[model samples]
Target: MLEQLSSVFFDEANELLDNLESQLLTLGDNPNDSETIAAVFRAMHTIKGSAAMFGFTDISSFTHEAESAMDQVRNGVIPVTGELIDLLLKARDHIRNLLDAGAEVPENYKQVSEQLIIAFKIYVSKNGGNASLNQPVKKDVPKIKKEDKLSFSWRIKFRPSKNIMKNGTRPELLIKELTEMGTATVVPFYHALAPLSEIDSELCYFSWDVILTTGKSENDIKDVFIFLDDESKVEIEKIDLLPGENNRIGEILVDRKDVSREELDKILKEHRQLGVILVDKNMVSEEQVQSALAEQQHLKSLTPGGQVATPQSPASTQTLRISSAKLDQLVDLVGELVTFNARLEQEAQEKNIAVFKSLSEQCGRVVVLMRDVSMGLRMVPVSTLFSRFRRTVHDLAAQLGKHIEMATVGAETELDKTVIEKLNDPLLHLVRNSVDHGIEMPEDRVAAGKTSVGTVTLSAKHAGAFIMITVKDDGKGLDRDVIRAKGIQRGLISENDNLSDNEIYNLIFQPGFSTAKSVTSISGRGVGLDVVKKDISTLSGTVSIETEKGMGTTFILKIPLTLAIIDGMLVTIDNAKYVVPLNAISECIAYSMPAEEKGQRFVTTTNHGKPLNCINLREFFNFGKEPPAKQEILSVYDGDEVYGLVVDKILGSQQTVIKPLGPLYGNCVGINSSSILGDGSVALILDVYQLTGLIKNSSKKAS
Candidate 1:
C-alpha cells in the first residue's frame, strides 16, 4: 500500500513539475504577472505537501525552500527576475530528479539542493531584510483562539455506520485531521454497542461529539470528511458565544414546532440546556437536535466573514488514470474487432440474405462509432508536447548568446498520443536545428536589415487524415551556393547537376552533412537531421523543406494522425494484394497501354489542367507477367512531384490494421507493413514516400 501511494505521488509530482516549468517560463516572459506567480507558488506548495505525505522527505524539504521563495514573490517582497526564474526552473528539475531516484539520493544532488537553497535565501535577503538561510520562512497559520470577530465554535456530531470498519476507513485519521484545524474536544459515545454475545468484531458501535473552536472556514473542517459516504452521519453547527446573544437554538426549535414553547420553558425551568433536556425527555431524538444545531450553524455562518459549508457535490465525470499499456491493449482489441467487422460485412454481402445484411450494416455502423470513440480517447492536444520546447529554446538562446523567440500556433491541434510521443525526438531535432543553424545572431540580423530578435515559429494543423507540423525561422535562409558546393564535395551530386531549390535544400538531411564552418558543443556535428529524417520515415511520415536566399527556412512534416489503423485503397498486382494509404492517393485514372517509344514506358496525363507523370507499379515491381488488359493509374503527390502507380486492378477501399513487417523483411523497400484482409489474406501496405524516393533513385540510375 505504501509503495502504491509513493508511485502515485511520483506521477503527480512529475506533472506538477512540468506545470511548474511552464509557469516559470511564462513568468520569465511577463515578470509582473501576479497570477502566474501565484500559480507557480501553488504548484510548489502542493508538491511539498504531497511529498511529505508520501514520505519523500528530500523532495518535501527542497520544495519547501522553493515554495518559500515563491511565497516571497507572491507577497510582493521580492520582485521577479530572470535569475530567480532560472533558479526556480532548476529547483523544479531537482524535484523531478528526486522523484525519479525515489528514496536513494542521486550523487551530488544534495550539494545542488544546498546551493539552490542558499541562492534562494540570498535573493530574498537582497530584496529586503536579512532572511534565514537555514530555516524556511513560515506563513502565519490561522489560529483558533485568535481574538478575531470571525472566530466561531463548531459543534460536530460524527457517527460512523455499524460496518464502517469494513469499508477500510480509519475514523481516527479523520478525527486527527479535525484536531489539526483547531482546538477540538472529542467525546466518544458507546451507547450503540451491543452485548458481547451479539457483538460483531468488524462493526463499529461508537460515535463522537466534538466541540471545535477555530477561525478557519467551515469548508476547511468539512474537507476532513470529504471521503465519507452517505453511510456516515455528520452534523456541524456554529455555537454563538457573543454576550447578549439570544438562545437561537431553542428559539429555532420552538419556531419549527419540534418542541413547543411550553415544553421548552419547562425544560429551561429544570436548570438544564434546552437541547440536553429535550433529548433526555425523548421530546426530540439525538438526530433531530443535531439537525436543529446544523440549521443554527448555517444561519450563523451567513454573517459577515462567515462561510457556509455545503456538502461537496460528486463529480459528474471522473477521470481514471489508466496505464498506457492498458490503453494500447484496448486499441489492439479494437483493431481486431474492426477486422472482424469487415469480415462479417463481406460475408453478409456474399450471402445476399436480407436479415443478415441488415444486421451486418447496423453492426458496421456501431463498430465504426466504437473505433472513432476509442481512437478519440487516445488523442491528446499537441500543446502537451509543444510546451516542453519553450524551456529548450530559452536555454539554447541564452547559451548561444542569441535573441530568439519561439512562437507556437495551433497547439490545440490534436493527434494520437502514440504519434505525438514518437514525434517528440524528431520535432526536438528540428527545433534545435532552427535555433542553432537557421536563426542568425542578433548582430547579423540587424546588419541584414531585420529585427535583432529572431522568431522561430512552430505550427501544426490538420490536413485531411494527416497533421502538418512546420518549424520555420526568420533568420538567414539556406545558401544555395554553399549547399551546392557541399553536395559536390560530399559526392552526393555532380557539380553541374541542375536541381530545384527544394531538392538542394534537402541535401542537409544527408548523413554526416554539415554546412556549419565551425564545430560547437551544441550542433556543428551534423548528426541530428539525418536521424530526424530516419525517425520520421519510420512512422510513415514525410519531411520537406522550403527555403529562400535570405528570407528564412521552413521544414514541414506530414504525418498520419494514427499508426494503428488506416483507410487504404487495396489494389491487386499479379494475383497479390497491396494497400495504398488513401490520404496519399491524389486520384485514379483509367490507363491504356501507350505506344512503345525508345523503351520509355511512362505515361503523361492531365490533372487540374496540368501534366501529371505516371509510373506503372507492375514494371517497377517487375511482376514477371503480361500487363493486365484493364488497369488503373493511381496518382500520388510526393511534395515535389506527382507520380502514378499502375496496378493490375483496383480492389476498392479497406480499413486496415497495420501489422509491422518482421526484421527478416526489414530490407524491403516500398512496403512498410502488412495488413489482414477480410478474407484473412495479407496485403502489404505501401509506403508511398519510400516508393517515390526509390523511383527517383531508380530513374537516376537508369539515366
Candidate 2:
C-alpha cells in the first residue's frame, strides 16, 4: 500500500512539475502577474506537502527551499526576473529528478542542488535576509471594531465524524495549530461516548468545545479545518460584549419584553442554555429563537476571507486515474467489437430477414456510438503536448541570440493520446528547425522589413476526418534556388529536373539532404526531417511543406484522430482486396483512355470542373493481367495534388480495424497496414502518401 501511494504521489508530482514549468514560462512573459506567481507558489507548496507525506524526505526538503523563494516572489518582495525564473525552472527540473529517482540523491544532482541553494542564498542576502525562508511574513489582520480594543472571542463547537481519523487527520495537530494564534482553552465533552463494552477502538467519539481568544479573524481559524469534510460538524459563534449589547438569547428576549428577567435568571440557574430555558418557560416560541440562531450561524460562517463555508456538493463529477495500458486494452476491445459488428451487419444483409435486419441496424448504431465514446476517452487536447514547446522555444531563442515569439491556435484540438505521444519528437524537431534555420537574427529580421521578433505560429484544426497541425514561422522561408542547388549537389535531383516550389521544399526530407551551410548543435545534421517523415508515415499520416522565398515556411502535418479503426473505401483489383482511407478519397470516375494518353500511367480527368491527374492503382500495384475494359478511377487528394487510383470494383465503405503487419513485411512499399474484412480476409491499407512518392520516383526514373 505504501509503495502504491508513493507511485501515485510521484505521478501527481510530475504533473505538478509540468504545470510549474509552464506557469514559470508564462511568468517570464508577464512578470507582474500576481495570480501566476501565486499559482506557482501553490504548486510548489502542494508538491512539498505531498512529498513529505509520501516519505520522500529529500524531495520535501529540497522543494521547501524553492517554495520559500517563490513565497518571496508571491509576497512582492522580489520582482520576477528572467534569472529568477531560470533558477526556479532548474529547481523544478531537479525536483522532478529527485521524484524520478525515488528520493535517492544522485551525486551529480547533489552538486547541482548545492549550487542552486548557494545561488538562492546569495539572492536572499542581497534582498535583505533569510527571514522569509525561515518565517512567513504575517499579514496585518483587520480589526472588526477600532473603538473596541478588546480581543475577539469565539466559542467553537467541533464534533468530528467517527471516521475522521481514517483519513490520516490528527485532531490534536489541529488543536495545536489553533493554539499558535492566541490563547485557546479546549474542553473535551465525553457525553457522546458509548459504554466500554460497546466501543469500537478505531472510531472517535469525542467532541470539543473551545473558547479561543485571539486577534485573528475567523478565516484564520477556518483555514485550520479546510481539509475536513461536511460530515465534521463545526460551529463557531461570536460572543458579543458591549455596554448595551444583548449578548445572550435570554437577554435579547428580556430586552424585547418577551421574557421577564426573573424567569430568565431562574432558568439559567438550572444550568441550561438560555434559549432552551426561554422555550421551556414559554417566554418565546421555539421557532422564533431557532430562526435567530440560524441567522447568527449564517453570519458567522461568512469568514473575513469573503468565502462562505458551504458544504461541498456531492453531485460534482469525480475522476479516477487509470493506467494508460488499461485504456489501450479497452480501445483494442472496442475495435474488435466494431469489427465483429461489421461482420454481423454483413450477415444480416445477406439473410434479408426483417427482424434480423432491424436488430442488426439498432446494434450497429449502438456499436458506432460505443466506438466513438471509447475513442473519445483516448482523445486528449493537443495543448498538453504543445505546452512543452514553450520552454524549448524560450531556451533555444536565448541560446541562439534570436528574438522569436511563439503563438499557438486550436491547441484545444483533440487527438488520440497515443498519436500525441508519437508526435512530440517530430514537432520538436520542426520547431527547432524553424528557430535555428528559418528564423533570422533580430538585426536581419528588421532589415528584411519584418518584426524584430520572429513569430512561429503552431496551429491545428480538424480537416475532414484528419487533424491538420501546421508549424509556420514568419522568418526567412526556404530558398527554392538554394534547395534546388543543394539537391543537385547531393545527387537527389538532376539539374535539368523541373520541380515546383513545394516539391523543391520537400527535398529537405530526403535522406542526407540539407541546405544548412554549416553544422551546429541545433541543426544541419540533415537527420530530423527524414525521421519526421518516416515517423509520420508510420502513423498513417502525411506531411506537406509550403514556403515563400522571403516571407516564411509552413510544415503541415495531417494525422488521423485515432489509429484503431477507420472508415475505409474497400476496393478490389484482380482478386486482391485493398482498403483506402475514406478521408483521402475525393471522387470516383469512369476510366477512359484518351488518344493522346495511350500507355500513360496517369490520366487527366475533370474534378469540380478542373483538370485532375489520377494514378491507376491497378497498374501501380502490378496486377499482372490486362486491365479491365471498364474500370473505376478513384480520385484521391494528397495535399493539393489530386490523383486517380484505378480499381476493378468499388466494394463500398466499411469500418476497418487496422492490424499491424509484422516485421517480415515491414519494408513493403506503399502498404501502411492490414485490415480484416467481413469475410475474414485481409485487405492491404494503402499508404497514399508513400504511393504518391513512389509514383513521383517512378516518373522520375522513366524520364
Candidate 3:
C-alpha cells in the first residue's frame, strides 16, 4: 500500500510537471493568460499535496513556495515575466529530478533548492506589497463596537455523501475547513450508525455542526457545504452578533437594514478588488463589507471558479508511466501464447480429428487477439516525445545566439511503445542536427527572404501500415556545393562520380561527413547522422532526404507500425517456409518463368528500365537444391517500388505474432525475427529492409 501510494504520488507529480512545462511555454508568448496561470497554480498545488503525503518533505515545501508564487500571478499580484518563467521552468526540472530520485537527495541539491526558494521569495515580495488594498491587514484582534453598529452569528451544519469519505474526505477535515474561515468551534454529529454486522466500512455516516463569531455572513458558512450539499444536508441561520460582531461588516449591514439590492450590487462589483472602492465610497460600511466578503468566500468554495479550464494541451496527451518489468512480462506471455498455438495447430493437422481441428482454429483466433492487445497496450502517442523539444529549442537557440521557432504537428499519431522508446535518441539527434545545421541565424533567414524566426517542424503521421515521421526546417536548405565538397573531402563521394542530387543528399548520413568548421557539444562533430541512419534502419525503416536551395529540407522516415505482430503471408523457399508481412506484399502472381524466358518483361523490372531486385531464396540461403517446378512470384511493394522474391511455394496468409530471436541470432541476416507456425514450427520473419538491400545490391551487380 505504501509503495502504491508513492507510485501514485510520483505519477501525479510527473503529470503536473508536464502541465507546468507546457503552460510555461505558452505563458512565454501570452503572459496575460490568467487561465494558464491558474492551471499552473493548480498543478503545483496538486504536486505539493501529493508530495507531502508520499513523505517527500522537500518537494512539498519547494512546491508550496512555487505554488504560492504562481497564486500571486493568478491573483494579479504579479506578472508572468519571461525571466521568472525561465526560473520556474528550471525549478520544475529540479522538482522532477527530486521526485524521480526519491527522498535520498544529494547534498549538492540543497544549494540549488535554497537559491530557487530565495528567488521565489524575491518574486513574491516584489509584488506582494502592491496587493489589493482591502486585503486583510494581518494583526491582533480589536475590541467590539456596540450601538451604532450591528452583530450577527451564524450556525452551520454539514453532512457529506458517503462517496466523499470514500474518496478520502473526512468530516473532521470539513469542520476544520470552516474553522479556517474565522473563530469557530466544531461539534461532531455522529448519530447515523448501523449495526456492526451490517455496516459497510466504505460507507460514510457522519455530519457536523459549527457556531462562529465572524465578519462573514450566513452565505459564507453555507458555501463550505457546496460540494457536500447534493449528498448531505446543510443548514445555516443568523443569530445575534456578539460584541466583536458589531464591528463586522456583515453584522452591521444586516442591523442597519442595508441588506438591500442596490448595496449588494455595488459590493459584488468591487469584490475581487478587495472591496476598497465600496468602503471608500461609503456605499457599504466596513461591517457590511465583511459580510459581503464572506459571501464571496462562500462562492469561492462552491467550485473555485474564476478561470477557464485550459485545453488538455499537447504535452499531457503523449506520455504514460509504465514499469519496464510489466512490459517484459507482457512480451513473454505473448511469445508463449504464440508458441502454444503453433503446437496446437500442428497436433490438430496430424490427428485429422474434428474436435482437434475446431479447437486449433479457435486457438489461432485467440492468439491473434492476444498479440493485438499486448501490442496495443504498448502503443504510445508521439506527442509525449515531442514535448521535450520545446525546451531543447529554447535552450539551444539561446546558446547558438540564434532566433528560431520550433513548430510541431501530428503529435497525436501513435507508435509502438517499444518503438517510441528506441526512437527518442535518434529523434533527439535529428532535432539537434536540424537546429544546429539545418536552420540558419535570424539575420541569415532575413537575408534569404524568410521570417526572422526560422521554423523547424517535427511531425509524425501514419501512411498505410507505416509511420511516416518527419523533421523539416525552413532555413537555408542543404548546400549542394558544401555537401559535395564535404563528400569528396570525407571520401564519401568522388568528384568524378556524377552523383545525382538525391544521392548527394544521402551523403550526409555517411560516417565522418560534416560541413561545419568547428565541432561543438551540441551537434557539429559529424558523429550523429551516420548513427541515426543505422538506428532507424535497424528497425526495418528507411530515411530519405529532400531539399531545395533556400527553401528548406525534410527527412522522411518510413517504418512498420509495430514490431511484435503482423498479418503475414506464408511462403516456401526450398521447402523451408518463411513469413512475409502482408502489408508489404503488394501482389502474388503465378510463375510465368519470366526469368527463364527470353525477350519478355518480368516483374523484376521497373518502369525506369532498371530491373527490380529479385531475391531467389534457393540461391541466397543455399537451402539445398530447388524443387523441379518454379513457384509463383510474391511481388511485395513499398510505395511505387516493387520486389520479386522467388520462392518454391505460396502457403497463404495468416495473422502471426512476431517473436524476437534470442541473443544468439541478434545480428542474423535476412530474418528480422521469428513467429510460430500454426503447426508449431518456428517460422522466420523476413526483414524487408535487409532483404531489399541484398536484392538491390545483387541487381546492381547483374546490371
Candidate 4:
C-alpha cells in the first residue's frame, strides 16, 4: 500500500484539492460554522497524509504548514479570518499547479510556496506551534502492525471500471501489489471480455478474484485500492477458517453469485457436489462452477488458520459519482432512440398494420418516458454553479474597497448541465458589471439614501418550459440620459432616433458600447456584455434589462430548460416547414389578410385591445407560392411582449430533438436550429425571441 501508483494518486489528489477549495469557500461564508471548520481541517489533513503516502514530497511538505494552520483553527487557538482564507486559497491553487505541471518547479510556484510557508508559520507560532509537523519531510512509511506476526485469510474481489485502462493502469500491477502482501491465488474473470475483432484496447473488461493468506491487516489491502475507490468496486472478506470448514464450497459459490442460497441448499440436501448439482440443474454454467471451485481450493490452501471470520456484510451506498462525458454519450444514444421510435410510429401509420401500430404505441410511450428520465439526468441544481462565486465576490469587494454581499434566491432551480456551462461566462460578466458599474461608492450610496453595504442578488425561477435567471443589484441604476449620450457618441444611435427606455438600456449589449470614461478589469472593456449577448443568443436564449432611474437594475435571462429537445408547434408555409417553440406561444387565432398589408413586412393588428405586431412568414421568407387569404396567427411572446407569427397552417405539437446548424447558418437570422420530423423531413426551428426582436426593431427603424 505504501508503494503508490502515480496515475491513481494524481487523480485522487486533484479531487481532494477541489474539495478543499469548496470547503474553504463555505468557511468564508460562515466563519463561525464549526462543522465547516472541522471539515476543512479533515480535508487538509487527508491531502497532506495522502500526498506523503504517494511520495509527493513537495506537496506533502508544503501542505504540512496548511494542515498545522487549520489544526490551530480546529483547536480554537485562532479564529478564521479573511486573511486566512485568502492564504489557504492561494495554497490550494499552488498545490493544484504542482499536481498539474508535474515535478518541474517553476519560479513563481516556489515564491508562492515560500511566502505561504512564512504565513503558515505565523499562524502556527500564534498557537505556540504544533510538535507533530516537526517530523522529517518524507514519504510516510507505514509501521508494522502487531498483526504482522499473526496470519489471516482474505477473499478479495476487484471489479475495476471498464474504462480503468484509459487511466494508464496495468491490471497486473494491482495483483502484484496484493501478492507482495502474502501468498495469493488469483483467478481472472473474462465474462465481459469481447472477441479479438471487437476488442477495445483502451477499455478494461477483466476482473480478478484473489484468495490471500497473509499477516497484513485488511486496512492495508483496502489502502492498495484507495485511489480506485470511485472508479472500481472492491470487496474484501476476512474469511480465516481452516481447510474443510463449514461447507466452504457452497459458501464460496454463493459469495460469487454463481448460485443462490436456496438453490445451493436444495442441491446440498441431495448430498452431491453443489457446483455439479447446480450445473446439472442448468442453474450455473460449467465455467461458473470452475470459478467457484478455484475459490474453494484457494481457501483450503489457507494453512490451519488462527481465528474464524464472520460472514461479510452487505455493501450500502446512497449515491454514485459518474463522469459527465458518459452522461453526454448516454443522452446522445437516447436521442437516437427517440428519433427511431418516432420513425417506427410513422411507419406503423403508413403501413396500416394493427399489431405493428399497437407495438409502436407501446414503444412510443416507453420512449417518451425515457426521454423524460434522460433529460432529467442532465438537470443539475444551479446551486453548484452559484456557490463558486462566493470567493470571487469576496476578493472583488476587497479589491474595490466596497462592502458588498451576493445574495442568491432559488438556488435549487435546475437546468441542463450544458446550458449551465455556457451560462457561466455571461453570469460572471453581469456580476462584474454590477459590482463595478451598478453599485456606487459607499459615500455616494449614502448620499443617494441607500445602505452602505450593496447587495447583488442572483435568482432563478421556472417560466413554463423555460427558466429565468435574474441578476439584480441594489445600487445606482443605469442613467437613461447618460446612456443615450454615450450611444449617440459611439454612433450606436442618432439624435434623431426616437427610442424607448428599454431600447436605450439594450445599447450596452452593442459591441464596444460603453458609457464609462475609462476601463478597468471588472467592466468597461465593452466586450463582456457583448459576449454575453452573443453566447446567450447561441443557446436560443434572450437577455433583457429592467432599470429605474434611481432604483437598482436587474438583468433577466430567459432560457430553455434543455437545449437538446423542445416541444414545438410545427407549422408549414407552402412547401417549407418551420417549428415554433411551444413555450413561446400564447394562443393561436385565425386572421384574415388585410388589404393594407399587401406589401408590408409586418401588420399591426389588435388583440384584446392591444396592438399586436404580426410578421407574415411567407412574405418574410419569400416562398414560391402566395399565402392563402386566411392566415393563422401564432401569438409569440419574446420575454417583452406578444407578437403574431403568421403561418400557413398549424400541424399540432411534437418532440423536436434539436440539431445545430453549426457555423454555416449560425448567423442566418431567425432560425435557431433544425430537427428531423417523424416523416424524415427537416423542419427549421424558429428563434421566436430573435425573430420578434430583430424584425420588430427593423420594422420600427424602417418606419
Report residue 4 deviation for candidate 2 (angstroms).
1.7
**Model 4 C-alpha lDDT versus the unseen true structure:** 0.80
Against the true structure, what is each candidate's TM-score? Answer: 0.72, 0.72, 0.69, 0.68
Cα lDDT, all candidates? 0.81, 0.79, 0.72, 0.80
lDDT of 2 by residue, 75-192 (tens): 5566688888888988998898887787567888778877887787778767764644645444355323344334566667688888888888777688788877765656666666
lDDT of 1 by residue, 296-315 (tens): 55544343334333333476
Ten-residue region with minimum lDDT total, candidate 3: 300-309
Clashing pairs in 3: 151-241, 152-241, 248-287, 249-287, 249-288, 250-287, 250-291, 342-680, 346-679, 604-612
RMSD of 3: 16.2
- Residue runs of model 3 more than 4 Å from their true location after superposition: 123-322, 493-495, 595-630, 640-644, 661-670, 676-681, 689-703
Error of 2 at 671 (Å): 3.4
Please give the lDDT score at residue 514 for candidate 3: 79
What TM-score does structure 3 among the candidates reach?
0.69
Tens-digit per-residue lDDT, 274-386, candidate 3: 34666677765564455444533332222112111234669868967678679868867887777677778778889999998998998888888888888788788988888
Which candidate tops TM-score? 2
Q: List per-candidate RMSD values in Å.
A: 15.5, 14.8, 16.2, 17.2
Q: Which stretches of candidate 1 lie over 4 Å from their true place?
A: 133-317, 351-354, 494-499, 584-601, 607-613, 624-626, 633-645, 663-669, 689-703
Which pairs, if any, clash in model 4?
none
**lDDT value for model 3:** 0.72
